[model samples]
Target: MVARRRHRLIQRRKMLGFSQEQLAHQIGVERSTVVRWESGEREPRPWQRPRLADVLEVSLEEVDELLAAQVNEEPEAERLDFAMRNPAAVDLVTVAHLAQRVQQLNAQYDAAPSASLLADAGHCHSQVTLLRGFAPNGRIRRELCVSTAESAILMGQLVWDASQRRDHAVSVQYFDQAISAAREIRDPILEAHAQLRKGFVALYGTKTPKEGLRLCNETAIVGRAGSNVLSGLGFLHVGEAYAMLGERHDCERALGAAEESFARIHNDDEALHMFSPTQFDRLAGSCYLFLGVNDKAEQILTRSARSLVRWKKSQSIVLSNLTLAYIRQGKLEEACGTLHEAIDLIAETRGGGGLNTAFTAGREMSPWRHEPWVQEISDRLFALMTT
Candidate 1:
């Protein structure tokens, strides 16, 4: 069953001005088939997806995302039903459902509002926590605890994001719980994720570079124990913390280590979800921006921006940083244009990271506040706040 609710297909259909019947006819399928596909009851056959993609004017990759969106919108009722029907058989099926649901929710993190998703995510976390308490002995219980760790980490993320990166204490509490749970299973990857998340709270939310750096180093150590790819990803954050500290030499070395790790990464690595193809460049761009090398930052961020379209919140952050790079370089018109684009994305997603970046960029433009375009941007931001 679908475990997340995303409306990519529905939005695409409306954008193309096609009704279910019309799309079905164009794709040579029954109207019911279109309804089923859109409603998450069924997926199109492999052979049929190409035609569907063509009709929807989406690429094969985008078609996959759209289909995944439809398939993951599973209802809470179904999970409760499973729990009720086979309290005795809840070992495998229930664990599988919860794992998939948590993963799906995490996948939507970049595009969905944390506030909109918090209740459902919290409910899932509670279910996992309850199951952990009464779960049967041995392997099943261990697996359930692992899932619980993941769910707890996700909860911490959602809570922090929903609070606009405030509520650091509560968020860190969840992360600590997640870390303890992972340690129970001796799962370094899970523990590393928790540490990295806690590092985020330190760096962004609390503005504690020392604590963030310490957590980042610890995360890298744990990741190195299990997977080189994950280690490299952790080092990227280490580099970020160093940049924030204005430690140029240390930042460069950390970034180089991250590159080496990236080079060693294979397709079979665990915790690959934490690594993004755009990660190094994106972080590198930010590092340069922090170091006041606006030209280099612009070069990197502009390139990464083009490749980050699918991740709306990530793209918004890149665009905001790119705007800052332009503003620092006195490229006033370019900065104004890019800020508008970032604002558009922030309006749609309300992503905390993006929202934070937007405001930071605006604050940096205070010297230009009297410019007509700058005034216009300020008005837009005010509207965004009131809205």
Candidate 2:
């Protein structure tokens, strides 16, 4: 196979008048390491990224794009053509492969642009749908449908994120399709997961806390039969909705119930896609932020933000909330610093939740627009808009 050239990296390096050895020397790496990276034989480490970005005079997000382009030059369809061509081969093993592919794309959701993965995810979803129709056994067919529902939900999320959460109608339609697919397979867990995502649309996209609360309650009911983790997550969203509505008593009660459910969660729970351990504190921090408890929000978010470093998209949301908490407390410098972190994560992930939170943080900073730090942050936000 011919080696794939990192054209963007090469162009940037040459534009900056640097040879491979000089560039590597500047970043304290071996010239062979630079050669390997440019030849697509190696990738830059996370710790080395900032310096690489500085040397290339490119944003970290741009570096990510360049790397992804190099690594995935071949379309996903080409890689999975065998499965698509021989739908009759749609057994448990094939299903496992499809599910693994979906998981791989899902893992990139927090680190890569949504548009980058949307095509492959859509193709994978379509293949799964086709395979289910050709599946010889009821068990295989049902499993395929489960995977289809997951793919549909992931497509909805990617579309929403790619559109910056502005295309609510399309996202909702995908969720509805996923819900129907799940119902057809009689998988309450999958159906509940779809409903939970719909709640997110209602809460964040439509700005309807009451509707979000109702959907979240429904999710909790179905999730109870499926997964303790998902049920707890549903109640956590319910608490968030209550907080949005300024129902302090109800919010606290729902949060307590969520905590109880979380404590009962075990490793055997399904709905792995919809649940995470960091979720409780993340949502709790957002709830406190909504309820005007800045101190409490800051406390929870600061701690949770550290733990969420592995998930840049989630960490961005936490950082956004922490920025808001700081802003509310008149900690302008700290708020500005956190806002920058959130914006940087947004540039990398382009996730809807983080983007919306970053913008919200910007709007909240308007009162202090005269401050140099606030103005500098505003400039950063402006650059994001133009880009």
Candidate 3:
């Protein structure tokens, strides 16, 4: 009998695109029991009627009506009454029913606007409430079945939020959570993503490129087969990290790896949408420029600046890097112009943290730190940093 009920429940849930864990939360049952029921190993007792009906969004009469309509049978009403009379059972049913309702409402709002354009704002609010009601360290500790892809997307949004607020701690915490979730799902692609984001946090938020390189290397390893774009990005990050460490050989090798990876990429993959071959060339050029290879750097940086005008989101970092290249070539006037454009883009988007970008640009400009032209840009940037 338990097997029949579980099968029916599973069918109903699949029609709704809900996972077993989601249904369990809705019906106030252990996920294990939900699994067992679907597997035909156990049955819900008569006492679980109210909660089950509530979760299914049907009335007791409606349930009876459906059952009778289908098979000309009736449940033993006396047994249900006996089970319903038990306070513990009744409380369990009530809680289960409430949880189901909350889950349903959350789904509805998730599908349609509840007064906001961002569906996650509503979800975030509801999740906070649901999280508060769960037992501390209980089976329902967190929302189960949140996939690695979903976690990465949410973490990216949180990172954007942290940058806007200048909350490095929050950004790091979110990245950590994203990494943990990715690992749990055993998705190498997402694991690489989490590591890359964490590396960004270290490089921009904390000025710790050494730590950032460690994270980037890990990303490159996991991302090699998962997505070439991310793998190439990881190599680029390692190159920057090595540049900061003044390890010219390591920097050159990392940059060469990035270039090769970029060259090998096919046009069919969607993961490359965030970056392009031009961006990769620019990244390589920027590293060369920083290592004092002025002519090679100019060739790469100029191409990057030209391509970046079309990729607005990347302009802040690209322009900043190009400004360094200009400085290295002794074109102080052009470098200042590029700096102004970068500052404007950073201010307009306010996406990547401005202070973080400025600090990196400042560090790259350290070779000419004493030069009046370099100091002039640094002074303006430093003033912005304090404000």
TM-score of each: 0.78, 0.76, 0.56
Candidate 3 Cα errors over 4 Å, as ranges: 1-166, 267-270, 353-355, 358-387
Off by over 4 Å in 2: 1-93, 134-137, 272-274
Quantify all predictions' global Cα lDDT against the true fold. 0.83, 0.84, 0.60
lDDT of 1 at 79: 55
Per residue, candidate 3 scores C-alpha lDDT tens digits across 1-387 of: 222343334434553446889778887888997787666566466777677677766677644532332232223233224334542232222223333433454334312222232354335433333333332432222222133233334444444533443556765665676567556556666667778888877766677888999999988888896778788889998998887777889998998898787777775443555556576776677677667787787778777777766555366667777776776667767877888777766554443543355456677678778978778878777665554
Model 1 misplaced regions, further than 4 Å: 1-89
lDDT of 1 by residue, 1-387 (tens): 534433557656754446789889899999998888877778799999889889876689878877775344445467557665555455443565676677778877788887888998898888877777777776557767887898899889888878878889999999999999899889998999999999999989999988999999999899998888778878988998999999989999999999999888886677765677898999999999988888999999999998998899889999999999998898988999999999999898887887788888899899989988889999988887776
State which candidate has the highest TM-score.
1
* lDDT (10s digit) by residue, model 2, range 1-387: 667877557645654446899899989999999999889788899999999988776689877855654544433345447657887765444565676676677668778988789999998888888888788757567767777888889999999998888899999888998899899878888898899999999999999999999999999999998788778988999999999999989999999999999899785676654567788899999999999999999999999999988899999989999999999998988988899999999888888899888989999999888988888888888877776
TM-score, predicted candidate 3 vs. hidden true structure: 0.56
Which candidate, 1 or 2, has the higher TM-score? 1
lDDT, residue 197, candidate 3: 80
Each prediction's RMSD over C-alphas, in Å, is 10.3, 13.8, 12.9
TM-score of 1: 0.78
- How accurate locally is residue 179 in candidate 1, as Cα lDDT from 0 to 100? 95
